[model samples]
Every structure is written in structure tokens, then in C-alpha cells.
Target: MEKISNFLEQSRMKDYILKTKLGESSLSTVWKAEHRTTGEAVALKQIPVAKLTRHLKNCLECEITFLSSVNHPNIIRLLNFFECEGCIILVMEFCAGGNLASYIRRRGRVQECMAKRFMQQLGAGLKVLKQNHVIHRDLKPENILLSCSECNPILKIADFGLSRILLPDESAETVCGSPLYMAPEILQFQRYDEKVDMWSVGAILFELLNGYPPFHGRTSVQLLQNIKESTSLPFSHLVLPELHPECMDLCSRLLSINPDDRLSFEDFYQHNFLRT
Candidate 1:
């Protein structure tokens, strides 16, 4: 932690301007910044030291270690890290095209082919992380970023705040992920692994095709019950009813209530919707 802070102090990047605020969650604020020396833009994620618990501080340190090991075109790049006042600032490549969540909110429903393209890009990014034995506990649309142009949205998975690096023989038993897209096993607090991410991908795909998730309710308990007991809507019932049955069937298998039954990443990649 001290080394990271010292390294940022020595960089001496000059003439920086705060372009705008990119995003804000409960614990951190993301800002868009420009580098005067290299004439490049970057995303600056700032987390206050005062606001961090010991656990959160450890998580932040782990995040730095994880980012250092990750490098992929479809994954957001962590350019640098620095300390300002009492805050830890993580400098990253700015995704000007915004996040997938914002895009979905703006356009209601995306075209089937376009949704598949984004999922393929997401899967490709996940493949890299999986190869490194990392799992992004949170895989919702909000964490998936886009490139600068709307014409070609380069999907890059962002926000490693909830991610974990698994050891070769280890399994995660803690339940931590977005409830809306969480796998049933996670809700039940059962031991789980990388397959939870596959369930989330299936949930995102369902929303992309049907314009909403399979489970909807006014309360958290209701939502949990829905997810635990819901049956997937067939592809034929989607807005684009012409979508191949194989595509919908794959979605069903991916979103299965039993995590043991969910599609593995390799099988998901081989599905006709993605392979086609």
C-alpha cells in the first residue's frame, strides 16, 4: 500500500484537468481526467481513506493487485494509482461510450444481434479473467463499460470492488453479489465458484431479449422468492419471437435454479447464439 502511494507521488504528471464526473456509488466517486503530457484521457476512481473499513482497505489493496495482473482489450485498463490528501485515486482508461446499464436505460431494448455482440465481448473478457483464476462476483450491466463510439461498443468489464482471485483448490463460501442477478446458490449461501457469473450472464441476456428480467417484484423478499421459484420465459415469447428456439433454451439452462446445472463458461461460449 505504501509503495503504491509513493509510486504515484513520483510520476509528476503535469497539467491535468477534471473533465467531468463519470460515476458514483456508495463508497467511491469516478471522475474523467486528461493527461497533459501524453494527451490521453483516463478514469479516476477515488476512494476516501476515512470512509474505508479495515476490510474495505484490504479489498482495495486486493483490487490493485488484481488490476495489475489483468490486461485485455475487452477489460478496462488500470493506468495508474495515486494518493491525494487522504484518498486513494485509481487512474483507469476512460470508457466514453458509457456503461451497458445506461445504454439499456436509454434505448429500452437493444437489437438481438447487438445484444449478442456485447455478450460475446463480455464472455471474451471473462475468459481472460477465468484463465487467471479470478472471478468477478458482480457481473451486472452496470459494471460493463463501452468504448467511445456508439457505432461499435467495445464491452469492457469494470469495477473489481467485489471480485476475488480463487486459488487452484479453493472455493468461495461467502454470499456477495447483486441480488437482482445473483445465482440461487448464492442466495442460499451455499459454496459456489465461477459458475455464479454464468448465471448473471444468463440474467443479463434474458433482460436484453425480453426488456426485463424474468423475476420482478416490489420487495427484496419477493424478488428472492421469484428468483428461487421462477421459470424462464421461452425465446418464442420474446419481442423478437423469430429468435431461434435454441437461443432461448440456452438462456433457460444458464439461468437454472441449481448452480450445479448452470452452463459452464466453455459451454456458454459454444452455444449456437454465441458461436453463430
Candidate 2:
């Protein structure tokens, strides 16, 4: 506790002034803050120490450890972190345009050109994560944010609490992630590698074009069953008719039931859909 107090004192000297509460979840609360000296805005995530279970503690440590070593334009940057008596504070790069989930909710489906641009940026970020041997277990619209509210805003990937650093031959079997965007392998409790993230990318791309997930169910059991039994994307004719055939093809490949058949990040970037 004494060490925590000292750390808080030192952090206060750095002059981060909290402005407004940005968002909150069961484990943490995020705030929009600014550096008093430089006036640079940042997102501050506060995780209460008292409420952390063993699993949550591990997640917190994993997120901080991995984020500190990564530096990429399309990935959210963790600038600083502090541990206080009651909570852990992480100062992260602020994205004024907010997350993709809200952006989609407001505009419904995004235009093809804009969706392509965002997908390209997201793919770039995933490439970096792959090079670093990290797998983002949870990849969804809510985990993606815009750098600014503009016609061609830079898309940044955020939320690494469920991420894991894998070895050359390692695969994760943890059935953890948002059910809506989870890969079929993950939902079926099968061993999955970084390819799971690609499946999620497909789900996001589908939602960006259609305003809803490819698979849906009234209950978790039903959702899992739907994902396991699903063989193809149930594309709406109204939306599909307007989108390029190449785009639809790419989505289908990415969301393939078999992980081995799913498009690799490199292939996705080079796909005709993105090229067009």
C-alpha cells in the first residue's frame, strides 16, 4: 500500500487532468483526460485493484505488458501506466471519433469505399500484431476506433484485455470473447491460432456492410450452435446487390467454417476487394 501511495504521488506530478468519463464496464472505467503541461488529450483507463479476480489481474498485467512493447500507427498506443492503492491507471492515445460500434449504429452500414479503407487499416494493424506473435482474442467493432471524425479517418485497434502472445506452434482453446464475433473454432472449443482474429475481421466487415452480424440467435447456446452449424454467410440480397462481388467473396473466405480455409491477413490485404 505504501508503494502504491508513492506511485500515485509521482504520477500526480506528471499533470494528467481528468476531464470526463468516457465509458465503463464491469472491470474498469475510461476517462478522457489531458496533460496539463502539454494539453495533449489521452484516454485514461482505471481498473480497481480491489475488484480484480485472479483472472482479471492476469488480464490486466498481460494487456499492460504487451501494449508497452508495441508501437504501430493503426494500433492504440499506451503512453503511461500507474498503480495506486485502489486502481491501476493506463494513459492511452485518445481517438476523438469514438469506436466503430457506435459509428456503425449512427450511420447504419458504411459505404463500400469507406469500409475498404477501414478494413485496410485494420488489416495493417493485425499484420503488426501477427509479427509481434500476439493474438487479439476479441476483435469486434467496439474494439476498433477512429483517430478522428472525418471522411477518411484512420482506424485504430483497441482493447487488448483478451489478447495473448503465442509461441510459434502454440494455439489457444479458451472459449472467451464476444459471442457475436467469435470464430467457429472458438465457439466449438477447438484449438485455434491467430486465424481466429481473421474470422472476427470477417464478422466486422459483414456488419460494416450489412448493419448486423452474419449469424444471430436469441440465446448463447443457440448462437454457439448457429456458429458451429453455419456453413455460409446469410447475406441480404438488398445489401449484396449493391456491394462489389469481390467484396462478398472476400467476406465469405474470411468467415469460412474451417480455420484452415480462412484467408490469411496478407491475402486479405492483397484481395481484389481491398484492391478495388
Candidate 3:
């Protein structure tokens, strides 16, 4: 709470009281705060406008614009935002269950039914992105949040730092996203379409089912090489017999190195893995 009082006191945004630091990066800090009148919990992300790079500023604008326009249970909501001094603050809903990464870390490999439910929710969120012509260049377990610690919690997609709008036929040439979850086309510096997001979803699904990422490397080149060489998903023997065939099929399709063959968001959302 004391960490953010100076900033809050300086601004007109004195209606909220910062309680704890949620996260921090070189460019911004996130704090969990409570509204003074309503006692509602919220996440406040503070970024210094003076220190923002061109790319970061663009990402901030995109995040604000995209979040403000859409409303979905699987997508993080923007409560309010205000600028003060040299900083830009974004107010968002506070997710109590932390992120999917922490969820997976604590539980290890999840049950088949649970993994399927997660994928379905992620797909539902992607539908919103597709409708808005947006590409969430960064999609990983760390960016996906849980609404609660209940037996069945809602998954909300968060962090639009690397997102951008891309039309149906358009492709993005940017080389960004986490190495482990990034598509081979992106790592190879090839222009890619929305299918790149599917690759990320595949990596998330792989981690959920097997408790590890599909590929690992010291560098991007090595990772690309690993993906190129692997003829099929390297499922652990322990789970090989336990996992459903449809689940494995969907995961393999999403991880396809060739974007041309990768499942589109439409096909992915309606995949048999989710249907069954």
C-alpha cells in the first residue's frame, strides 16, 4: 500500500487504495487496489509515459482500445484508466486465482476434462480477438488468469502488450512472443497469420496435459531446429496411455510448424477435442 501512495496522492485518482504489489517489470508496476466507496477490488497497472518506447506506447494504446471495446467473461475487463504526471495508469479487474502458469505449477499435469475446459475457454476468448481483427502476439499461461480457486474457475485472457489488429487475410511480420510458445514461422522471420496464436495455444495445451512445454532450446534458432526436427509431439509415456486420442490430435494440429496447415480459430473452437 505504501509503495503506491506517493503516485496516488499526486493524482486525482485518490478514490482507490493500493493494497499489494501484484507484479512489476522494467516499464510498469501492477498493484491490487480497493475502491474507497464500493470496496471493489481492481488491478492498477502503472507505466511511466516519459520512459515509454514507441512499441510500448503502441501496445498500451492497443491494449486500452481493445479492452475498452470488448466484453467477455474470458477476456479481462478494463474498469477505468487515468493519466497523471508522467505516468499512464490502467485499471482492470482483479483476478483472484492468479495466472494459469501458477495454477499449472501447483497442480502439475491437469486432468483431461480440466484441460479440455481450459482450452475451450481460451478458444472462446480467441473468438473475440478474431472478431475484432486483433492478434494477441503474446499468449501464454502467464497471460491467462483464473477468476477463482473453485473447482471450475473462469479463464480470462490478459496482457495485450504485444497485441495488434490484423485483418482476416493480413499477416504480421513481427518477431515477438515467448520463445517456447512462439510459432516456427515467427522464429524463422516469416510473415505469419492468426495461425501463430494457435501455435501458442498448442504449447499451452501441451503444458497442461504433460506438465512441460513441447520444445526447449538455449536460443530461438535451436528452438526452431527442435520444432523442425520433431515429426510428432513428444508426449510423455506416463500420459500417453491416459490422454484421449482427440485431445492429442487437437494439440498436434495446433503445433503444426506450417501455418498453412494449422487450424484456424473457427476450426479450433469447434474441434472434436472440445466437442467430445
Candidate 4:
């Protein structure tokens, strides 16, 4: 295609070299690339414009627009972006420590102190998103990455494909996100707000402590029903009696079935679990 040819020509002029494939999704492919002149290592997420539907295009635009507007230590940075060859390339910060999901798999379960540290950073990032009127519909370990391989690596939130900018009076209605992490409102098709993210945080915290999600189901229907009906913390059942009571309390408040009763960011930061 002419577009691809022009992209190649332009890439030669820019002196950007694609070194290795990092990852791929249905809508995009990511590669590790370098700036020939500056010798900077950057992650390049390339989306084939030719293959994108209108919805996918909107998703790409949303990610670029939101990421470019926000800057936080715990949120992944979007350095630069360009379009070429019927594709859009997003240059991003390179995180060498990989995703939190893989980190959890390697370690089984995270210690309380480490989980608290990571949650604090994640909370800070979420606070920024709240202030900016943006909602990250999908918040899971896979979307959280480490800055480097260190004794205590800084966590950075990534993958904004399912995120959305909320209007002052609007509540999102679309059901999205991983089933186990979905809030009750989302599963029941009720209009929901940023509180859905809090629910996800609770799920993440549970998994970090127990090495698995709080809710499990053999089928999708059963999962939704379980989420709807289950509202109490099963500390004894999960064999996590050693966990701090304050921690369990915070988790309960976060995963509240009623959004209004869920812990606010201000309260979350002041909670005894984090304070200790």
C-alpha cells in the first residue's frame, strides 16, 4: 500500500529503528524501538488504521487524548505519537520490570508491606484520574507495570484502551472490564461512576493477599450472581486470619455493593491500613 511505503520513507528520515516485538493485541502491536540519533529506548504501540473500526478508532483516540493530558509518577507516560502508513504509533516510556500480574505469579502472594506500598501508589494515580474526571474502566494487575527490576519497584498504571473521560453529570452505562473485577453496578447494567474503580482496587488487594480473586465462579452467569449477592469479607474462609483487621475493613468498604457507601479517596488515604 502507498501508505505503508510512505511510512517506511518517513521512518528512514526520522531514524527510528524497531528493535523487537514487545507484545500484541487484536487492535495493535507493540515493539521496542530506539531513536537512532538520541539512542532512547521507547515502547511503540502501533495500531493499524486500516483494520480499525470506528469504535476501535475512538478507543485509540481516547487513550492518546487522556494520557497526553495527565502526568503522574504512578501513571505510565506517553512521550510522543504519530500516524503513518495507515497506522498510528504511540511512543511510551519503557518499563523493564514487566506487569504486576506476572510479578504476582512469580511471588505467589505479595507481603502486606509491599502490597500497601503498591496500593498507595495506585491510589495516588487513581486520585489523579478522579480529579481529571477520567475513569479507567479496566484496572487489573496486568495493566499495572513496574518501573524497573528493583527491591521495591515503583508501579505505574498502563493500558488506557478501555478508559473514558466522564462529563460532570454523566455515569457510564456500558459493561466493560474483567468479570472477576467488575463492580455490582457494572454487572447489573446500572449507570456507574468512578466507584467502579474502587471495587477493582479491592479485588486487586484481595488477590495480592490471598493469591487469588475474592470471587470465583464456574460460569459467567454464576459470577455475576455471586458478585450481586456476596457483600461480606470471608476472611476465615479464605484462611487469611493473620491479615490486619483494618485491611479487611478497608477492603469491605471498597467492595461495597452500594456505590454511595464505598470509601472515598480522601477516606482511603487516611485509612488505618495505609497509615500503619
Candidate 5:
């Protein structure tokens, strides 16, 4: 709390020197920065306040509200934030290990044990989301981050721009999230609930094990068609023989095309695939 207070009093755009350009999107740019006084390393996210629409502002507010209220190891930490110049600057703890998208690209497919570990961490983070009734409309390898580069990296969930609070009993109609990771219901413009997030988690877990997404499309329509026509998840033939039956079952349950048949948060978190 005291740390945040000091930032409130002393924050300036010039207080930190931006080093590396970490990531970028239409909404914001992330940079690796070093504070002048303490030389503390942090990820600086700059959003142009002047350019924000009402909906975008609401999204930012939702993200800040959720991140500030939670303190979980699997979720990225928002240290401090302040308005400066024409931008709303967010200071977040630096994750030296980069993001899961890059990791998966470089490694192709990881061993089953490593994939299980990553899935377990993802489940831990999703547990927090379920408890809060927040739907992370976007959940993909790019949004999932790593903690360090030298040793095994700890997974951290990031990028909550498309997230919204939706009670378990209610549903949302917003059609958002990356197409490959998005649930089929979302693709078909149907109302969706927390189960959409389950579909995304399944896509991520599938990619972690197979080095590619479960489904693909050149466009949204094509993707929806492929999803509708698909019979089963395309697991790598070489990797299938070595995978545990529980692992296969969990993935199948998560990626179920029918929302009613999808794994609920409790069932997914308690699945046997993660027991090891």
C-alpha cells in the first residue's frame, strides 16, 4: 500500500526509462522500463487516455479493478498506475521469460510432464477467475506469460482487455476473443457464459501438448464451419501413444462443441490429468 502511495505522489512519464519494446496492440504498448531512483525493472503499459472510447475505458476499468483485487501467483501483478501526459501508465512486475506463444513456437511440442505442469498452473489461475465470476473472453498462448528465462518459467495470465464479470447463472452476448482460441458458440454469435473460457483453456492445453491449436480457419466463418464439422481434436499421432488416458479425456471434455457438454470449472480443476 505504501509503495502504491509513493507512486501516486512521485509518478512521471520521465521517471522511468523505457528499454525494450516488449509487446504491442492497437490499444496499448508494453515496454521494459527501469525506474530512475531504484533502478527497479517493470513492464510499463501505456494507453492513450485521449483516444479511448467509452467501451474501451470501461474495459480498462474492468481490468484494473480485477487485477488490483487479486493476489495470485498465476496471475500477473499490477504494481501501480497513474495518469501522465495523455496516457494512463500502468506499472506491472516484469516477466523476463516472455509469453507462452513465443515459448510454444520455439519448443514446438513440450514433454507430457511439462505440459501437465503448465496446465496445472493455468487451472490455478482459472480458479481465481471462476471464484470472482469473471469471464476472460480472451485466453490464448499470447496472453499467458512466463516468469523467467533461465530456469523453468512460472505461467502468469495477462491481457484482460476482453474480460467481463458474468455470474455463473447469467450469460453474455459479446463476440470477442481470438478466433482460434474462441469457443464455437462465440463464433456462431450465440450467447455464451463461463464455458467459453473452458473452450479457450482446452485450446491452449491442446497447443501446449501438440505445438498447434486444436482448430483453425482462414476466417471466422471457415473456423466455425470447421468446428461444426470436426469430430475429434487433432492430436499428434506420435504424441498420442505416450499420453495418459486422463489427459486425453480432459482435453476432449474441455473442447466439447456443445456448451452443455463442456467441462465446468470445478470438473476441470479437479480433473485427474492434473493430479500428477
Candidate 6:
């Protein structure tokens, strides 16, 4: 805590003006800044460098390291990094369009064509990460960011606090993610692989069609049970012919209860829905 406090105290705008606070959570704070020289705007995330438990601090460092190494059009770009006092500040490209979760809430369920576009871009981003041996444990609407007003609202995966780089033989044991989006394997608390991410994509696809998550309850336990048992009854079966069969097919394969039975990237890419 002392390190973070000192870092905050030392923070000074190098070439930008602090406009306003965008958001805040327990771990970090976000600010909108306008570059003084370039006249460009960006989002600045300030992470406490000190006083964090060693585990959390290592996590933050991991995110920084990963972001620095990886780059893709659909992924959020890290613009700058600096240390102030005991705080570490990351300046990132700002996406004025906001996250997909808030976007969906305001616009309601998106069109099948539009949702497919999002899924393709999201898959592209995931492909890059998986090729690098990084598995994003949290894959949900909130993490996807829009690119611009005119271009396809590209999905930029962000927030890597729960993410870990998987070793060749290493399998993840820790089960952590939003309950509604958790894969069957994850809820079981068993050692799992990258397939958990596929399950999340499936859940997101289902929500895109139905305007709400497939699983729901007043509490966490109920939500988990819903995921465990609700796999066979798809949201598509309820909507039926009203919804495109192609879209429904994609969702069904994505939401498969068994990770081994889920669609592979090759299969997903080959789907006619995306080709169209």
C-alpha cells in the first residue's frame, strides 16, 4: 500500500491533461487523458505498485508483460508505461465506443449477422493469444472493446488479472470467472485447459441471441447448477425457426457440456455462418 500511495503522489502528466475519472475498481483506477502534444486522447490505468499482496502484484506485472509482447488490430493497444512514486501507470489507446456489455444493454440483442462479425474478430484475437500459449480465463462482453465509429466494432480482449501463461504440460487448477460464463469443467474445479475460453464464447453467443445469459439465479450456487444441467436445453430450441439455424448451430457447438466435444478453431472458422 505504501508503494502505491507513493506512486500516486508522484504521478504527473508528462504530455497529457487528466480530463476525468472513467471508472474504478478495488485494484485500479482509470482516467481519460488528452495528449498535450499529439492532441490525441487515451485511457490511463494506474495500478498501485506497492502494498499489493505479492500474488496480485505479480499478476499486474504479468498483464503488463503480456500486453507489451502481443499486438493485434482487435486487441487493445498499450501506448505507454511509466512509474510514478510507487504506482505503475499504463497509457492505452482509448476506445470511445465502450465495452460490448454496456453496448448490448443499450442496443438490446444484436442482429445475427452483426454478432457473427463480432465472434469472428473475437476468435481472431483468441487465436493469436492461444498461439502464444496464453489462455484468457475471463472472456465476456465487458472485456471486448469497439474500434471506431465506422469500422467493425473490433473485439479487444482486456483485463488480464486472472489470466495466466500456460506451460506446455501445465494445466490450470484454479477456478475463477463470472459464474454465468463459467464452463462446465471450471465449475467442477478440476484441472482444465484452454477449452474453458471456448465455453465463454459460447455463453456470450447465447446471450447475444437471447438478450440475457443462458444461466441465471438469485445466488452463485444456483447459477452453477444451471450451467451444469442446462447444457442440453439450448436457448435456440426456444426461439427455433425465428432465429437463423446457422447461428443456432454455432451456439450449440460452443455451449457443449464436454470440453472435448466443443468446436475447434478450425471448425469455427470453417462454419458457413462466418464465411457469409
After aligning candidate 5 to the native by TM-score, how far in Å is the CA of 40 from where it should be? 1.3
Give the C-alpha miss distance for residue 86 in model 5, angstroms.
1.9
TM-scores, each model vs. reference: 0.89, 0.92, 0.94, 0.89, 0.94, 0.88
| Candidates 5 and 6 compared by lDDT, better number | 5
C-alpha lDDT score of every prediction, in listed order: 0.80, 0.86, 0.90, 0.83, 0.90, 0.78
In terms of lDDT, model 5 sits at 0.90
Clashing residue pairs in candidate 6 are 1-51, 7-86, 7-87
Candidate 5 off by > 4 Å: 1-11
> What digit string (tens of lDDT, one per residue) describes model 1 on residues 1-276?
988765666553334567899889888999888987777888889888899877677667767887887788999999878777677888899998898887888777777888788878988998888887888888888888899656788999898887777866678887777888887788777888889899899988877776676676676577778776655553434475656677677788888877678898889888888888
**Candidate 3 or 1, higher lDDT:** 3
Q: For residues 1-276, write the lDDT of model 2, one tens digit per residue.
A: 977778765766357888999899887889999999899999989888988877667777778888898888899999988865477889899999999998999898888888888888998898888888888888999989889887777899998878878777898777778989998788777898888899999999999998888998787779878876876678777787788889888999999888889998779888988876
RMSD, one per candidate, in order? 2.9, 2.1, 3.6, 2.8, 3.3, 3.4
On residues 1-276, what C-alpha lDDT tens digit does candidate 3 reach at each position?
Answer: 854866765654688899999989777899999988899999998989987878878878889999999899999999888886668888899999999999999998898899999999998999999999899988999999999988899999998988988887788797889999999999999999888899999999999999999999998999989999998899989988999889998999999888889988888999999988
Query: In candidate 4, which residue ranges exceed 4 Å CA deviation?
Result: 1-9, 12-14, 234-239
Candidate 3: residue 265 Cα off by (Å):
0.9
Give the better candidate number (2 or 3) by lDDT. 3
User: Which 10-residue window of candidate 5 scores lowest in summed lDDT?
Assistant: 5-14
Better of 2 and 4 by TM-score: 2
Clashes per model (N, Cα, C within 3 A): 0, 0, 0, 0, 0, 3
After superposing all C-alphas onto the true structure, candidate 6 shows an RMSD in angstroms of 3.4
Clashes of 3: 0
Model 4, range 1-276, lDDT digits (tens) per residue? Answer: 977878775775376788999788777888888889999888888888888777667666788988999888899999988777667888899888888888889887887778889889998888888787888888999889899888889999998888888866688887778888888888888999888888999989988887778887886678877877775765445447667788888888988888999987678878889888
